[model samples]
Target chain A: MAVDGTRPYGAYPPGSETEQVGIMTSTVTILYFAALREQIGRESQVATLPAGGMTVTALLAQLGQQDPRVAGAFAAEPRLRVAINQTLGGLEQIVRPGDEVAVFPPMTGG
Target chain B: MSVPGAGVPKVGSPEMGSPELDSLGAGIHVAVQEAPFDTASEIARLSALSDRTGGVGLFFGQVRGGNGLVSLTLEHYPGMTEKILHALAHEAVQRFGLLGCTLIHRVGTLRVGEAIVFVGASAAHRGAALDATAFLIDRLKTGAPFWKKEEFADGHASWVAAREEDEHAARAWSQDTPPPA
Candidate 1:
């Protein structure tokens, strides 16, 4: 079960000084959906974001490099949307450790 | 409106309930069921929830008789289903200044003339509500992970293929211009 956490705007709430310099550490959850889920063969997984403030696009690039299946699904850009926590966000959205990030194809539900 | 021991959340449980109103709030209702739904009551529920809205647009999708086909079974990836619906609902809210919305889709065995899906939207005027309702339904049919298996009257069954037109319909919404009427 994905626990519902209270992170506004899918990012960490503003202002908290807990920077771990040079450690490159943060626990995060990743969610996949639709054809992306089918291609990845897994719906959800936990990962550690690269240190030095990773963006949604960079994280996706990393996933693509790690798994050819994921790379194939994201071969074309702008076909997918990233949401942090639960709200829709842009590719520039900053991802932090312990944040829940979800990547899905363009939505098609009522 | 209720199912026992299905592990599904209740209609107004806090974890899944809306804070703006007594039940699931004035806008949006989401449900997944195994049995047939009563169209009249569903419509009434949606209408009753609408407030200060000038129009209510409804889309009721039904199983069709394809000569010998008699029933259909729907399947979905559970966790993904909820996540996708929640995301879609948020988009609908943003796209249209909707007063209220409702989505009810039935899974498992369903026969012709039975309701397969329902989408309702309310807005200050007819245009937004009507367009948003259509957009939501079109997107849901193509985007969601749900799949249908049709059963013929002769006991034959097969998975329904995804239509390219449906994908096009969904993609059209991403554009700035309105779809043709």
Candidate 2:
């Protein structure tokens, strides 16, 4: 079965799947800045995440493979931090569709 | 304008006596300016702002002619920029018993010799005030998310490289032990 990206992670919302059949999938927003932004070209972009299960690290790996610059950026591992909707989260955290994930260098700001 | 803590009236206050000099007195004021700063006004504001505090510390960071670079532009992450600045100010106040402090950082296009940042601090003694001023500026330069794009005289523009030295300066502040009484 082709997994629909629009469906939220885990169990689908009650009855909504049946109510709206064949709806095009939606995409999530990813924000990049500084070196990351320069490499990505665009400051922010919308992407569709694979269904079933995907950890933050896994998602990052996929992004890296898609863009060589992104791959080089995350090669430093812990040097880069990830935030979901502005709050810091670990790599294992599950990301849902429509979530805004921001990737940037370790914060040096006061 | 009137002095910060003084009973005098504010600079622009209608009740003030002279148009040139307001109740706040004639000297120290802090402003994030688009045009080049007036050194005379800055000196006046600094002098007027001082009172019981025996020491006044100030830092003026200007955009350097980056190897013959004529123009520079600063970019910052909107909401996050202001949030970080406010947090830094609060931290400075808590760490040092500062009488008063002012920080003004300009964002956007700027030319060489134009002031990019201003940090002012006042305390009971000079030592504390000077240290606090240094600490604030050091932290702001390294920790802040602002990025600078330098346009050289050759018409080429590039993002300024992040300096490890700045990080070291900020790290020193974290390691410092409180001074002895």
Candidate 3:
């Protein structure tokens, strides 16, 4: 059961941050959707950020280095958008630890 | 104007303890569900939400069968989608001084020609209602978080890219959408 009644779209796995980041507190739950999700082959992941925080652009650059699929997807679709904690934001927005970051292609819904 | 589902209904009272509305009247209803919404019922409900409503405007979008499309799959960010949709609907209601409004967007896989999204707004005059309706849908296309993937008859499926024209439409409305006259 999801924390909410709705099905779990994506949630952090149990202690996923600890497992990935070891002792880093600068970790965030990252989510992908649509074309980006399909390209990345994973719906969500917990990633460790630098000590303080990083901009949405910096986070993508780091993630792309860790996984080239991220690079290719963003390269193929240059219009990828990002949101911090479910709020749509620009690439320059700073993403802090424990924030939920979502990266996806342009919205086609109405 | 007597019984519901009988004769021409009036924009009158909601049923006792109706979840859809209350004595104060529900100003907005936003649904991001899988099942298709009844466009006619939604329009009627919008008008019935208030007695001062003189006109109602509706916009419905159905999937197109062109380009050998078989079905379209809609994916949305669950927690984020509802939040953004309600915010959009609330803005539409307040901005247009609408009496009430209903906005529904369907998810899951849908066949061609199926209703994908619908928005209806009621107001004192047609202008407010129509402009609100247009504003709601246009903003939703660019603002909402739903994504669509089209499945072709040849077993090839592709995600629908956001259209530039949609951005222009939303921007146009933001510039100077007049109030009710």
TM-score winner: 3
lDDT by residue (B1-181, candidate 1, tens digit) is 2222133333345655455432323366767666666777766765676567787888988888977988876655344455556556657766787776877777666788788888888777888889988888988987665667778877777656566688888889988876887
How well does candidate 1 reproduce the true complex, by DockQ? 0.10
Candidate closer to the true structure by DockQ (higher is better), 1 or 2: 1
TM-score for each predicted model, relative to the true structure: 0.57, 0.64, 0.82
Tens-digit per-residue lDDT, A59-106, candidate 2: 888778777766876774346767664455788998776566667765
TM-score of 1: 0.57
Give model 3's DockQ, 2 decimals: 0.31
The recovered share of true contacts, given per candidate in order, is 0.15, 0.15, 0.66
Best by DockQ: 3
Clashing pairs in 3: none
Q: Per-residue lDDT for B160 in model 3?
A: 88
Alpha carbon deviation, residue B110, candidate 2 (Å): 0.9
Model 2 scores a TM of 0.64
C-alpha lDDT score of every prediction, in listed order: 0.65, 0.61, 0.75
Full-model lDDT, candidate 2: 0.61
Q: Ranking under TM-score, best-scoring first?
A: 3, 2, 1
List the candidates ranked by DockQ, beginning with the highest: 3, 1, 2
Q: Compared with the true structure, what per-residue lDDT tens digits does model 1 show for residues A58-107?
A: 88887788878778877743467677755567999898876667787654
User: Candidate 2: misplaced stretches above 4 Å?
Assistant: A1-28, A47-56, A72-101, A105-110, B1-51, B176-181
Candidate 2: TM of chain A?
A: 0.68
Number of clashing pairs per prediction, in order: 4, 16, 0
For lDDT, candidate 1 versus 2, the one ahead is 1
